[model samples]
Target: MGTVKVLVDDLLYYNKKDWNAKVGKAKKDNVLTVVSKIKVKSAYIYELISGMYITAATKFLKFTSK
Candidate 1:
Protein backbone atom coordinates (compact mmCIF):
# COMPACT_ATOMS: atom_id res chain seq x y z
CA MET A 1 0.00 0.00 0.00
CA GLY A 2 2.81 2.35 0.88
CA THR A 3 4.69 1.56 -2.31
CA VAL A 4 1.59 2.16 -4.41
CA LYS A 5 0.90 5.40 -2.57
CA VAL A 6 4.44 6.57 -3.24
CA LEU A 7 4.04 5.80 -6.94
CA VAL A 8 0.77 7.74 -6.96
CA ASP A 9 2.46 10.68 -5.27
CA ASP A 10 5.12 10.63 -7.94
CA LEU A 11 2.47 10.52 -10.63
CA LEU A 12 0.60 13.43 -9.10
CA TYR A 13 3.77 15.47 -8.77
CA TYR A 14 4.74 14.64 -12.33
CA ASN A 15 1.41 16.03 -13.52
CA LYS A 16 1.71 19.14 -11.35
CA LYS A 17 -1.37 18.15 -9.32
CA ASP A 18 -1.94 18.33 -5.59
CA TRP A 19 0.14 15.72 -3.79
CA ASN A 20 -2.47 15.24 -1.04
CA ALA A 21 -5.55 16.21 -2.98
CA LYS A 22 -7.86 13.85 -1.19
CA VAL A 23 -7.95 11.29 1.59
CA GLY A 24 -8.39 7.52 1.72
CA LYS A 25 -9.96 5.83 -1.35
CA ALA A 26 -10.68 9.20 -2.94
CA LYS A 27 -6.94 9.67 -3.39
CA LYS A 28 -6.74 6.60 -5.60
CA ASP A 29 -9.48 7.95 -7.85
CA ASN A 30 -7.52 11.14 -8.41
CA VAL A 31 -5.05 9.31 -10.65
CA LEU A 32 -7.58 9.54 -13.48
CA THR A 33 -7.18 13.31 -13.54
CA VAL A 34 -3.71 12.95 -15.00
CA VAL A 35 -3.57 14.34 -18.56
CA SER A 36 -1.24 11.78 -20.07
CA LYS A 37 -2.83 8.45 -20.91
CA ILE A 38 0.57 6.75 -20.75
CA LYS A 39 1.28 8.07 -17.27
CA VAL A 40 -2.18 6.98 -16.12
CA LYS A 41 -1.57 3.51 -17.45
CA SER A 42 1.82 3.37 -15.74
CA ALA A 43 0.36 4.45 -12.42
CA TYR A 44 -2.45 1.89 -12.69
CA ILE A 45 0.03 -0.86 -13.47
CA TYR A 46 2.19 0.11 -10.51
CA GLU A 47 -0.84 0.05 -8.22
CA LEU A 48 -2.10 -3.26 -9.62
CA ILE A 49 1.27 -4.95 -9.14
CA SER A 50 1.61 -3.64 -5.61
CA GLY A 51 -1.91 -4.87 -4.79
CA MET A 52 -1.15 -8.26 -6.32
CA TYR A 53 1.91 -8.65 -4.12
CA ILE A 54 -0.06 -7.71 -1.05
CA THR A 55 -2.80 -10.18 -1.93
CA ALA A 56 -0.27 -12.96 -2.52
CA ALA A 57 1.45 -12.30 0.78
CA THR A 58 -1.81 -12.28 2.66
CA LYS A 59 -2.81 -15.58 1.09
CA PHE A 60 0.61 -17.12 1.74
CA LEU A 61 0.42 -16.19 5.42
CA LYS A 62 -3.25 -17.23 5.60
CA PHE A 63 -4.05 -13.86 7.13
CA THR A 64 -7.33 -13.41 5.31
CA SER A 65 -10.55 -14.41 7.00
CA LYS A 66 -12.71 -17.00 5.36
Candidate 2:
Protein backbone atom coordinates (compact mmCIF):
# COMPACT_ATOMS: atom_id res chain seq x y z
CA MET A 1 0.00 0.00 0.00
CA GLY A 2 0.96 3.63 -0.53
CA THR A 3 -0.24 7.15 0.12
CA VAL A 4 -0.53 10.30 -1.96
CA LYS A 5 -1.07 13.93 -1.10
CA VAL A 6 -3.18 16.03 -3.41
CA LEU A 7 -1.23 19.03 -4.69
CA VAL A 8 -4.04 21.05 -6.20
CA ASP A 9 -7.44 22.14 -5.05
CA ASP A 10 -10.49 20.32 -6.44
CA LEU A 11 -8.41 17.65 -8.06
CA LEU A 12 -10.41 15.50 -10.40
CA TYR A 13 -10.99 11.90 -9.38
CA TYR A 14 -12.32 9.30 -11.77
CA ASN A 15 -14.16 6.03 -11.47
CA LYS A 16 -12.30 4.25 -14.24
CA LYS A 17 -8.71 3.82 -15.19
CA ASP A 18 -9.47 5.03 -18.71
CA TRP A 19 -10.25 8.41 -17.14
CA ASN A 20 -13.49 8.70 -19.07
CA ALA A 21 -15.73 8.42 -16.07
CA LYS A 22 -16.12 11.37 -13.73
CA VAL A 23 -16.56 10.47 -10.11
CA GLY A 24 -15.80 13.27 -7.65
CA LYS A 25 -13.26 15.81 -6.47
CA ALA A 26 -10.56 15.83 -3.81
CA LYS A 27 -9.18 18.87 -2.05
CA LYS A 28 -5.56 19.89 -1.93
CA ASP A 29 -3.27 18.50 0.79
CA ASN A 30 -5.62 15.58 1.28
CA VAL A 31 -3.69 12.42 1.92
CA LEU A 32 -5.31 9.36 0.37
CA THR A 33 -4.60 5.69 0.68
CA VAL A 34 -3.60 4.10 -2.63
CA VAL A 35 -4.68 0.55 -3.23
CA SER A 36 -2.61 0.17 -6.36
CA LYS A 37 -0.88 1.91 -9.26
CA ILE A 38 -1.73 1.35 -12.88
CA LYS A 39 -0.19 2.47 -16.14
CA VAL A 40 -2.61 3.66 -18.74
CA LYS A 41 -0.90 4.54 -22.00
CA SER A 42 2.12 6.55 -20.91
CA ALA A 43 0.62 7.98 -17.75
CA TYR A 44 0.53 6.46 -14.32
CA ILE A 45 -2.69 6.45 -12.35
CA TYR A 46 -3.30 5.72 -8.71
CA GLU A 47 -6.27 3.77 -7.42
CA LEU A 48 -7.56 4.87 -4.06
CA ILE A 49 -9.12 2.57 -1.51
CA SER A 50 -12.40 4.31 -2.21
CA GLY A 51 -12.19 3.01 -5.81
CA MET A 52 -11.38 6.45 -7.24
CA TYR A 53 -8.73 7.06 -9.80
CA ILE A 54 -6.33 10.03 -9.89
CA THR A 55 -3.28 11.00 -11.84
CA ALA A 56 0.08 10.07 -10.38
CA ALA A 57 1.90 12.95 -11.94
CA THR A 58 4.42 14.63 -9.72
CA LYS A 59 2.91 18.02 -10.39
CA PHE A 60 -0.45 16.86 -9.17
CA LEU A 61 0.48 14.55 -6.26
CA LYS A 62 3.15 13.69 -3.80
CA PHE A 63 3.52 9.93 -3.33
CA THR A 64 4.89 7.98 -0.36
CA SER A 65 5.14 4.37 0.66
CA LYS A 66 3.09 3.14 3.56
Candidate 3:
Protein backbone atom coordinates (compact mmCIF):
# COMPACT_ATOMS: atom_id res chain seq x y z
CA MET A 1 0.00 0.00 0.00
CA GLY A 2 1.10 3.53 -0.71
CA THR A 3 2.00 5.78 2.16
CA VAL A 4 -0.57 8.51 2.66
CA LYS A 5 0.76 11.83 1.41
CA VAL A 6 -1.22 13.58 4.08
CA LEU A 7 0.72 11.62 6.68
CA VAL A 8 3.94 12.98 5.29
CA ASP A 9 2.48 16.45 5.06
CA ASP A 10 1.33 16.20 8.62
CA LEU A 11 4.71 14.96 9.70
CA LEU A 12 6.35 17.94 8.07
CA TYR A 13 3.79 20.25 9.61
CA TYR A 14 4.70 19.17 13.12
CA ASN A 15 8.21 17.78 12.58
CA LYS A 16 7.53 15.25 15.28
CA LYS A 17 9.66 12.20 15.99
CA ASP A 18 6.70 9.86 15.86
CA TRP A 19 2.96 9.52 15.37
CA ASN A 20 2.07 9.63 19.07
CA ALA A 21 4.29 12.62 19.60
CA LYS A 22 2.32 14.55 17.01
CA VAL A 23 -1.10 13.04 17.47
CA GLY A 24 -2.74 12.07 20.71
CA LYS A 25 -5.41 9.61 21.77
CA ALA A 26 -8.52 11.17 23.19
CA LYS A 27 -9.15 10.07 26.76
CA LYS A 28 -12.91 10.56 26.89
CA ASP A 29 -13.93 9.27 23.44
CA ASN A 30 -10.74 7.32 22.78
CA VAL A 31 -10.38 9.00 19.42
CA LEU A 32 -6.96 9.90 18.01
CA THR A 33 -6.43 13.60 17.71
CA VAL A 34 -3.67 15.31 15.75
CA VAL A 35 -2.30 17.89 18.17
CA SER A 36 -1.10 20.58 15.84
CA LYS A 37 -2.07 23.86 14.29
CA ILE A 38 -3.48 21.94 11.32
CA LYS A 39 -6.78 20.11 11.35
CA VAL A 40 -6.99 16.54 10.08
CA LYS A 41 -9.20 13.50 10.47
CA SER A 42 -7.67 10.36 11.94
CA ALA A 43 -9.00 6.82 11.58
CA TYR A 44 -7.71 3.28 11.73
CA ILE A 45 -8.84 0.28 9.64
CA TYR A 46 -8.89 -1.95 12.72
CA GLU A 47 -11.91 -0.05 13.92
CA LEU A 48 -13.97 -1.27 10.96
CA ILE A 49 -12.27 -4.65 10.56
CA SER A 50 -13.12 -5.52 14.11
CA GLY A 51 -16.58 -5.49 15.68
CA MET A 52 -17.93 -2.20 17.00
CA TYR A 53 -18.01 -3.78 20.45
CA ILE A 54 -14.41 -2.61 20.95
CA THR A 55 -12.33 0.51 21.28
CA ALA A 56 -8.97 1.38 19.72
CA ALA A 57 -7.13 0.52 22.90
CA THR A 58 -8.99 -2.80 23.08
CA LYS A 59 -8.06 -3.66 19.51
CA PHE A 60 -4.47 -2.71 20.20
CA LEU A 61 -4.51 -4.85 23.29
CA LYS A 62 -5.85 -7.83 21.35
CA PHE A 63 -3.17 -7.46 18.67
CA THR A 64 -0.39 -7.20 21.23
CA SER A 65 -1.93 -9.65 23.68
CA LYS A 66 0.24 -12.63 24.43
Candidate 4:
Protein backbone atom coordinates (compact mmCIF):
# COMPACT_ATOMS: atom_id res chain seq x y z
CA MET A 1 0.00 0.00 0.00
CA GLY A 2 0.96 3.65 -0.44
CA THR A 3 0.71 6.65 1.84
CA VAL A 4 -0.61 10.17 1.73
CA LYS A 5 0.24 13.15 3.90
CA VAL A 6 -2.21 15.85 4.68
CA LEU A 7 -0.88 19.23 3.60
CA VAL A 8 -3.68 21.37 4.92
CA ASP A 9 -5.21 21.73 8.35
CA ASP A 10 -8.69 20.34 8.97
CA LEU A 11 -8.90 18.62 5.65
CA LEU A 12 -12.33 17.22 5.00
CA TYR A 13 -13.12 13.54 4.86
CA TYR A 14 -15.96 11.85 3.04
CA ASN A 15 -17.74 8.63 3.85
CA LYS A 16 -18.37 7.77 0.25
CA LYS A 17 -16.69 7.93 -3.14
CA ASP A 18 -19.05 10.56 -4.50
CA TRP A 19 -17.75 13.05 -1.90
CA ASN A 20 -21.23 14.41 -1.32
CA ALA A 21 -21.19 13.77 2.40
CA LYS A 22 -18.77 15.06 5.01
CA VAL A 23 -17.69 12.55 7.59
CA GLY A 24 -14.69 13.84 9.50
CA LYS A 25 -11.46 15.81 9.31
CA ALA A 26 -7.79 15.02 9.15
CA LYS A 27 -5.19 17.39 10.54
CA LYS A 28 -2.23 18.69 8.66
CA ASP A 29 0.95 16.63 8.65
CA ASN A 30 -1.08 13.51 9.29
CA VAL A 31 0.13 10.51 7.37
CA LEU A 32 -2.56 8.11 6.18
CA THR A 33 -2.32 4.70 4.66
CA VAL A 34 -3.98 4.53 1.27
CA VAL A 35 -5.90 1.36 0.56
CA SER A 36 -7.01 2.32 -2.94
CA LYS A 37 -7.46 5.19 -5.36
CA ILE A 38 -10.28 6.24 -7.67
CA LYS A 39 -10.76 8.98 -10.20
CA VAL A 40 -13.87 11.12 -10.03
CA LYS A 41 -13.98 13.40 -13.04
CA SER A 42 -10.75 15.42 -13.02
CA ALA A 43 -9.86 14.74 -9.40
CA TYR A 44 -8.56 11.70 -7.64
CA ILE A 45 -9.87 10.33 -4.36
CA TYR A 46 -8.11 8.09 -1.92
CA GLU A 47 -9.71 5.41 0.24
CA LEU A 48 -7.87 5.31 3.54
CA ILE A 49 -7.30 2.24 5.61
CA SER A 50 -9.78 3.42 8.18
CA GLY A 51 -12.43 3.55 5.43
CA MET A 52 -12.45 7.31 5.21
CA TYR A 53 -12.21 9.15 1.95
CA ILE A 54 -10.11 12.20 1.13
CA THR A 55 -9.34 14.15 -1.94
CA ALA A 56 -6.01 13.68 -3.70
CA ALA A 57 -5.55 17.32 -4.48
CA THR A 58 -1.87 18.25 -4.64
CA LYS A 59 -2.53 21.48 -2.78
CA PHE A 60 -3.91 19.52 0.17
CA LEU A 61 -2.06 16.23 0.02
CA LYS A 62 1.30 14.70 -0.80
CA PHE A 63 1.36 11.13 -2.01
CA THR A 64 4.18 8.63 -1.68
CA SER A 65 4.69 5.11 -2.85
CA LYS A 66 5.90 2.32 -0.65
What order do you get sorting by TM-score, best first?
Answer: 2, 4, 1, 3
State TM-scores per candidate: 0.16, 0.90, 0.15, 0.90
Q: What are the Cα lDDT values of the candidates?
A: 0.23, 0.91, 0.24, 0.91
lDDT at residue 35 of model 3 (Cα atoms): 20
Kindly list the per-residue Cα lDDT of model 3 for residues 6-32, writing each as its tens digit. Answer: 211111111232234333232322323
Off by over 4 Å in 1: 1-16, 23-66
Q: Number of clashing pairs, model 2?
A: 0
lDDT of 1 by residue, 1-66 (tens): 222222222222221222333223323223222111123322322223212111112111222121
Top-scoring candidate (TM-score): 2
TM-score of 4: 0.90
Local error of candidate 3 at residue 25 (angstroms) = 17
What shift in Å separates residue 15 of candidate 1 from its native position after superposition?
12
Tens-digit lDDT string for candidate 2 (1-66): 899999998888998998777778899999999999999899999999988899999999999997
Clashes of each: 0, 0, 0, 0
Evaluation by lDDT, superior candidate among 2 and 3: 2
